[model samples]
Target: MALLAAFVGTPVAAAADDPDLTSFYQQKLSWERCGQDLQSGARSDGAGQPPGFRKRLECARLEVPRDYGNPGRSTMQVQLIRLKATGPGKRLGSLVLNPGGPGASGVNYLIDSGNSFANLGRRYDIVSFDPRGTGHTEPVSCGSKLAPPPGSGADDSLAAKEKRINEACGRYSGGLLRWVGTQDVARDMDVLRAAVRDDKLNYLGFSYGTKLGAVYAHEFPRKVGRMVLDSVEDPTKNAWQTALSQVRGFQRALDDFAADCTRQADCPLGTDEGKAQDQLRHWYQQLSEQPMKVKGETVDETSYVYALREALYSRSDWPALRQALEQLRHGDGAGILRLSDAGGGSAAHSDSVPARRIGQDELPPQDQLALRAISCRDTSERYGADDYPRAERELTKASPLFGPDIAPTLLDCYNWPAAGDDASRDVAAPDAPPLLLVATTNDPATPYQGAFNMARELRNSSIVLTYRGEGHAAYTTGDPCVQRHVDDFLLSGTLPKSHTSCS
Candidate 1:
């Protein structure tokens, strides 16, 4: 989930008849400064920040109740970054963004990647906010131990590191983890809508952001005007179901990679597709038995395998993978080590151990128990403790490279200490707006099929908008067909017929 924008209107206020509503639509709001006056419009960098373009966007802060159930309690300030509209008339309020990770910083992303939305900012205000506990918000922290070590490779030593990470995430993620789920975030968005004074919300969501949009649409149907959910994941799926599908998604990407690698001249795994696949499988096995080392750093089979799977998430990283494969073939570990460092960090930017590096203002500590409680409770599928070992074995059989991580993630969930009864109640209301589901044929995370299934479940959703391309979500950088469909939907309230494929 990422955001982009241009500002369109002065903030105002609107009232909802529901007295119990914690959020309402409002615009043209005037806040008095304490002896200092700040401009009342949006802000940006004021330059052509190419590719996505940049603007010295406007910003403001809104006070929100710490708990929606009680408005009179403690309050927290939510920061907003806006890209104002170049249009003249009273333009649409805003198109806010969120990037997945449930942890990724939307404001930072918009600042870094806003140029990509060169065409979208003309008509609407592009706005992004640091979600609760995310970057710059009341950030979550894991202390010093959670930082990823620099570099990567295949070494027997990393098994301990992986275990340490899991343990640290469990221990340091305090009660805050439970509150960061999509449901809670949707509530946050509603508050944002009210604070910004918009009768309806327009959104463009990517990956996990799609889940956020889906939850918002379900909870506040009337508030949604237009939305585009790219690389959609069905929130209704249980943890096991989600993991199982992700395994298959990676397999699909792997197959695509293998086929392409065989056709290339410098194919590191060699020209024979079968041979390349065999070499990859054998390499993982070899790493499991004896890990490789880089600059005295040892990485285990699981770390190397996880890196490989994670690398497939972007086509940009494919070249790095090819180089890593070559190193693995020659028994050198430097390339993989580099990949590991890029993905994992031993410390936050603060040079402290990762757990402590992230400031408290960025994310609230997570409650693993509560996280499991909500996820399991919301999921219809249940797994017994004994079920994991068998499931892990089967998952491994599906793809050796990704299986270990997927299995471990699921096993962790199975053993989750949270009670599942709360989420057991159904939350999806199929009668929401006609959702526009977009998916890339080769998304490594939430695959195309996942979008297909989601579209199937939501009767009001348009047919899946299939982008015959690679990468996670294509709404921002997809082909013209994909882009126009999204643009049409977002700007004109038009939905694609049945299912549309953008090749």
Candidate 2:
């Protein structure tokens, strides 16, 4: 509350006056040849790629407030990429995108999947930025290895580990920890909208990005143009509720996987649902007693659960998950370890893979730490170790396979340095134009209910496109039907009928 009080008393103009951000909003970017060190996806349109499109990507940096309230205190640069529209169609200004991950890098996303934006790219300049505390935009750093060695932390209490992380972030992170919340990022988005010269914000945000997009709508409702939120998160849910939702979501995906697995003759989980669940639970017990090693890294019960949770985000990974589980019975830990190290190496974002880096492996340590920094700062929930046991029992009962893995997330904000504000979660954009929300029924990261919840909060101004499918996102799944609706909306501002469902 003190944090909020300090910012609220800033007169808001103190920032613009102190830092004189009018200069920032008026400054123009100097584009240059992008470096391979930065680019993630293939550089150009591949064979059979989208037509009328070629990658003319360029990179630049935009200056923003390190502390938005007291902008004169400091400044930080936001890394951004632009995929100029290639089509002969009349330009529709700049179309900005955020690929969820409150911690995900939009710069990498645009460069990696430039071709995916061919349709919109031809009509609008597709732009993305690495939000603060992520990518090259002054990312959060924990100074040391985030987790204590596999078995070493076992002796420490849960709160001790939490304190260790809090101390490390407080020590490092370049003094940017307190300012990386979604509200700050949304403020950055407005500056981004201005820097790009877009009269209004046209955006595509997925997962946590949806939270970002919705907050932007609330903050700058009149400035919103066409917006699409996929794999949505219910901003109203605090950190603990969000964690609980993910637990249930992962468990639901597991049941879905189990049901799908039994139909296969070579199913490792067996034919009966009951037996399949029992088998999985039994493997958890087995892995707990005898951890596996792969490529010089330890794979304990915690890693095993994470690997499974990672696979549940997309059905495409289910085959790998099955293979991993099968190979586990045969004592090979390589497959599951790969999945564990997958998902952009971040902890929570259910994003399958970046646009350009197919079969990419090894998520950066910073991404994992950034997730904690941004999520903790936005979430006001300050769960203590005393609260862990009850949440654990409840989550475990909800999902014996995934609950333990998620229980620890509830405590992420315990000793966080910055105080979280309600503005990040309040998405009451009553005056904003209608927005499109694409949600998948079986999404494990941002459950479908979150999308529906978002629509409700938007005051019935959002159209919900339900894809009764699996995966964390809908449009990226290559479902022509889903893509058509999204393309039509982004390209021509068409909205599917309300309560529309696509299989």
Task: Name the candidate that leads on lDDT.
Answer: 2
Model 2 pairs in collision: 41-356, 112-356, 345-363
| Cα shift from native, residue 345, model 2 (Å) | 8.7
What are the lDDT scores of the predictions, listed in order? 0.60, 0.77
Per-residue lDDT of 30 in model 1: 39
How many backbone clashes does every candidate have?
72, 3
Q: What tens-digit string does per-residue lDDT give for candidate 2 at 415-482?
A: 88777766677888988999999999998888888888899898847899999998787877778898
TM-scores vs. true structure, each candidate:
0.76, 0.88
lDDT of candidate 1 over 1-503, digit per residue (tens): 01111122211232453234333223233332211122211133434465333325566666665565555555566666777776754576678877655455566656655656656777787877766666555555555545544456522233333333444545665444444455656776876776665667799877767777877877776677787888887655666666777777788788888788888887888889888889888877888799877788776676576557656666667888888888777888777766755531100111000111122123223422222333433443445445767767877777666665566445333433223342422335465677788988888678677777676655565557888876676866536888898878877788888767887
